[model samples]
Target: MPGKSGEIIDYIKNDLERDPQDIKTIVVTHHHFDHTGILDKLKKITGAKVAIHSADADYISGEKTQHGSLFMIPIVMFMKIIYRSRPVKADILLEDGDQIGDYRVIHTPGHTSGSICLYNPINKVLFVGDNLMYSNDKIEGPRVVHEPENYKKSIEKLRNLDMGVILTGHEQPITSGANNRLDTFLTELYD
Candidate 1:
């Protein structure tokens, strides 16, 4: 699910309310509004550093427009007009294989030209942001892609990895045997 700002703030507030001593870090897989909506608020509330891939840095820094579909143009225009663009700066710019806490950055672009995934080797969890989705016990490739070839390559890369849990940005989260399902989907793409 796209982490909205209000929801994210509430989530952090609840976390801190439960344990004020806990360390927090908001790891955004990309700069999409849905993923970044509460980013600034979460950073302020938890005093957590925001991390994003360097390839998307320009877009987040307000230097470039966010890549969006033609269908999303009206909504983007509305957001630009109604909401003052509070350009967010990432505390840490990530690179492929870079570690954030227990998670490793996986540059899986194509969904937005700068998309990424977070993989935790110990937990075997893959936090894929829109690069992949789960539905009906299956792993589905991206619904939209700015670069189809790159997206396909990303899916193949992820399929090769050892993952047990697939936490997608949308739809239900897959808890077990996710890697196998993802591999099947990738293989089918070739056939």
Candidate 2:
């Protein structure tokens, strides 16, 4: 989990209440605070195993140094506090093709060097974390907050998938039939 706090757990609890048995595993697209904020708490509450990419296991497990931009300081601090209060450990180390429930984990490294996206082919939904961001009717490349080249590659990788919905990590969700929009945005990045 990202921060492993109580507020995040409440949000998950409400969702679980709506469909208690529907969710099988709690998958962390990456170790970012916003995505993983309630991971450990949710796991304890739901008894569902927590899954994260193996590449990020060390970072999330506090075995490696956490590096990021100035804006990420708060997240790092939050993580430190959470870890101090209640240390968390991932129950499952996920791989590129590992399936969690109906979604497959696609390791789209760029945003965090170990970032991932959960692709559900049946629903044509992708839970992409910082790989792409949507704004003003356009699904564009991620902000130049980290490695721009890797970010561009990740955008291209995600664009090739037959996705109907793009659930980004930081912004509002992008609806179906937006592949062309994403393609154009990625093309602009390449150009």
| Candidate maximizing TM-score | 1
Candidate closest to the true structure, highest lDDT: 1
Error of 1 at 41 (Å): 2.0
- lDDT scores for all predictions? 0.75, 0.72
Q: Tell me how many clashing residue pairs each candidate has.
A: 2, 2
lDDT of 2 by residue, 1-191 (tens): 44445555556567555443344677777776666655656666667777788877776676765567777777677665857533358888988788887888888777776788888889999898877788888876665444555676666667777888889877889896668888788778778
The whole-model C-alpha lDDT of candidate 2 against the native structure comes to 0.72
Q: Model 2 reaches what TM-score against the true structure?
A: 0.81
Off by over 4 Å in 1: 1-4, 15-24, 80-85
> Which ranges of candidate 2 are over 4 A from the true structure?
1-23, 82-85, 144-147
Worst 10 residues of 1 by lDDT: 15-24
Task: Please give, for residues 88-114, the per-residue lDDT of candidate 1 as tens digits.
Answer: 788888888898878888898788767
